[model samples]
Target: MSVPILKQGDVLIASIQSALTDRDLLQLKDELAEKVGRLRSRGVVIDVTALDVMDSFATRTIRSIAAATRLRGAETVVVGIQPEVAIALVELGLTLDGIATALDLEEGLDVLVEVMEARRRDR
Candidate 1:
């Protein structure tokens, strides 16, 4: 199933509130990219708090989404990662390397705001 994507100001928030299959994640990436471009959003916050695990496929999908969003001129922040999931990801040697993360949805939004502000200043 596709996740819910919300637009708040210039930011797009996508909450993955259920366990998603590979196909679902692929759909999510497509939807998010489309929404970002259509809405002209400057940032994206993906809330993954409900996810119990962070497998390699899921991790890669997130990375891909972030990269694609960046190319579309939006910053992506992933929030609500459980402690166990973080530990498992590290143990599996998947560091989610270049993706930005936050503790929760509120923090994620703040991070996105900060990133957008920085971009504005740089430009």
Candidate 2:
């Protein structure tokens, strides 16, 4: 199933409501990248609260999504990673290296706001 991406102010919120296949993950990455540019969004928040499993492919795809959107001039924040998933990713040696993360959607948006504000100040 296709992920629903919503435009909230200058941010695009892509909430993953279920466990997605590799194809769905790739589609989401592409869709978010395209929308970030088309919508001229300053930030992207990906909520993965409902995702119980985040395998290597999913982790890599999410990292690529962040990198792609960043190149398009939008900051990306991933939120709602469960404790078990976090431990699993760490044990598997998969890291979300350069991507920003938050505990929930509210914190995710807050992080985006802070990052956007910092960028503005830098400019």
Candidate 3:
């Protein structure tokens, strides 16, 4: 499985296709962390439509990416979560309070643009 990275206007959109198991999670995590620093803009949209599950480690990696992106003066947004996975996350008592999520790519891009615009003004 390959992770695709695309630049969408002012946003760097990363799509994690196929299954995101613990084995490959960290590789994606590392790449994401690296992108936070290299991104031309401080806005990211991580498309998780293909992800069927979010284990503890994967959740941890997402948290780490969020933290790292924020540290780099950027924001991370998760998009298109599988219904069951969303339910599981809630049952697990996971809090995505600060993390923004979108229902699809279009919405994710909209949110990313808004966040990036706000960041631009602040900086």
Please, what are the lDDT tens digits per residue for candidate 1 over residues 73-123?
999999999999999999999988878899999999888888889888999
Q: List the residue pairs that clash in candidate 3.
A: none
lDDT of 2: 0.94
Candidate with top lDDT is 2
Q: Rank the candidates by lDDT, best first.
A: 2, 1, 3
User: Candidate 1 or 3, higher TM-score?
Assistant: 1
Q: Estimate each model's TM-score.
A: 0.96, 0.96, 0.86
Local distance difference test values of all predictions, in order: 0.93, 0.94, 0.80
Worst 10 residues of 2 by lDDT: 114-123
Candidate 3 contains a number of clashing pairs equal to 0
Q: Candidate 2 has what TM-score?
A: 0.96
Candidate 2's C-alpha runs over 4 A off are: none
> Between candidates 1 and 3, which one is better according to lDDT?
1
Encode model 3's per-residue lDDT on 1-123: one tens digit a residue.
Answer: 557778766567889888766757777767766776776557778888988878777778778877787787778899999899999999998757788899998998888878778877888
Q: After superposition, how far is residue 32 of candidate 3 from its true place, in Å?
A: 2.1
